[model samples]
Target: MKSRQIVLGILKSGPQTGYDITQLFQTSFAFFFDSSAGMVYPALRKLEKDGMVTKEIVPQQGKPDKNVFSITPAGEAEFAEYLHSPVEAESVKSDFLARLMFGEFVDPERIVQIVKDEIQQESEEIEQLQQRLSDYLPSHNRCMSTGQKLAFAYGINSSKTEIAFLKQWLQEHPDGK
Candidate 1:
């Protein structure tokens, strides 16, 4: 999904500043969606310009005013329409996968190192997501729902698969491990 849609869908929960939205991306949406810190502001501006959202400047003590975004009725309708639209196919863009595809060009030792590093990173991510799921599931009035929990489960499962694949690949391309 587009970052604009993600931002608008988030605004439906309540008004939030760009920082707040980015934080949500980091903590909650990080597993499934790939939103960058830079994407939030531009999406907010476009939404505001399109009258899909309205912004309010919230005053803070000893800080610059925060621009909080709220979804308009039109935005809600738009989001509902998006929900009705057929699910988009996810486009994979993995540098590691690409590198592995062209493994012959790289040194075997380097390939082994890369897969090992990926396994470590993926394992770490799985651990973090497990912790987040634990914290999220028990919270009262949590932002996440059963559907979101399922998504987290999917991520955990995918990460497990990735780690397994990497291990096997490393074994096949062994360089005196």
Candidate 2:
């Protein structure tokens, strides 16, 4: 998803400064996507120019003035249009799968370590996603479209299955041999 669209949605909820928006992306949106100030500031500027969103300067003590932005009516309309648009298919480029495909070239020890770490990471994510899904279930926020909801489920299952595969591999190679 485009950074601007994500930022716009956040703004739609309420007004937020650039810093606040970046922090939100880091914490709440971290699971799905991420953005740095480099990308966010530029997008905010572009959104301002495009009249999709508006920014106001607010003075802050011991820091520079903050640019607080919120989505305009035009921005909301544009976002709704994007919602109706077809989603671009995600590209699959897995380095782990590549290593597994050419397993002979990889050291057995490193392969085991990689699989162990990968499985652990995915397992934690799956657990967190399960919690998030439960929390989001009661919310009336129709902002999460069907596509996004579907992807979220896919992400949970994908992580779970990946962990399952890695665990099976570990069982098969008890000594990492």
Candidate 3:
């Protein structure tokens, strides 16, 4: 989905500053969507220009004025339309996978090291996801929707599965041939 749609979806929850929106992307949306201030500010400007959102300047003591954004009726309609739209195909852009595809050209030792590094990285990701799930799932801190919980489960499970596959492959090919 486009960044504008994502921004609208976030605004649907409530009005927020651009900084708040960016934080949500970094925390809540990090697993499934990649966004940055560079992307979000522009989308916010465009959405404002298109009448999908409204921006209000809020002055702060000892800080810069904050631009708070709120979704307009048009933005809600757009987000609803997005929700009804057909799901896009999953896009996988993995540097490790690309490197492995050309493994034959690289030294065998390098490939072994690469696979090991990937396993470590995936393990770290699984840990972080588990921790976030724990922090989010409590009744007092239930910020994530059921759908988000499911997505986190999928991410953790997939990372575990990938690590298992990599370990088994290493075991089967002890020589890294």
Model 2 Cα lDDT, one tens digit per residue, 37-150: 578888889999999998888999999988889899999998888778898787566777787778788788878987887887888988887776666556536566786588
lDDT score, residue 143, model 2? 65
Q: The CA-based lDDT of model 3 is what?
A: 0.88
Regions of model 2 farther than 4 Å from truth: 124-157, 175-177
Best by lDDT: 3
Once model 1 is optimally superposed onto the true structure by TM-score, how far is the C-alpha of residue 6 displaced, in angstroms?
Answer: 0.4
lDDT of 3 by residue, 1-177 (tens): 988899999899889989888877776677778777678899999999999999999999999998999999999999999999999998988999999999999899899999999999999989888876776567325477787778898988999999999999999987789
Question: Which stretches of model 1 miss by more than 4 angstroms?
Answer: 134-143, 171-173
TM-score (C-alpha, index-matched) for candidate 2: 0.75
Q: Is candidate 1 or candidate 3 better by TM-score?
A: 3
Give Cα-based local distance difference scores for all models: 0.86, 0.80, 0.88
Model 1 agreement with the true structure over 96-163: per-residue lDDT tens digits: 88987888887878778878888999999999999877776564256666778788989999999989
**Best TM-score among the predictions, by candidate number:** 3
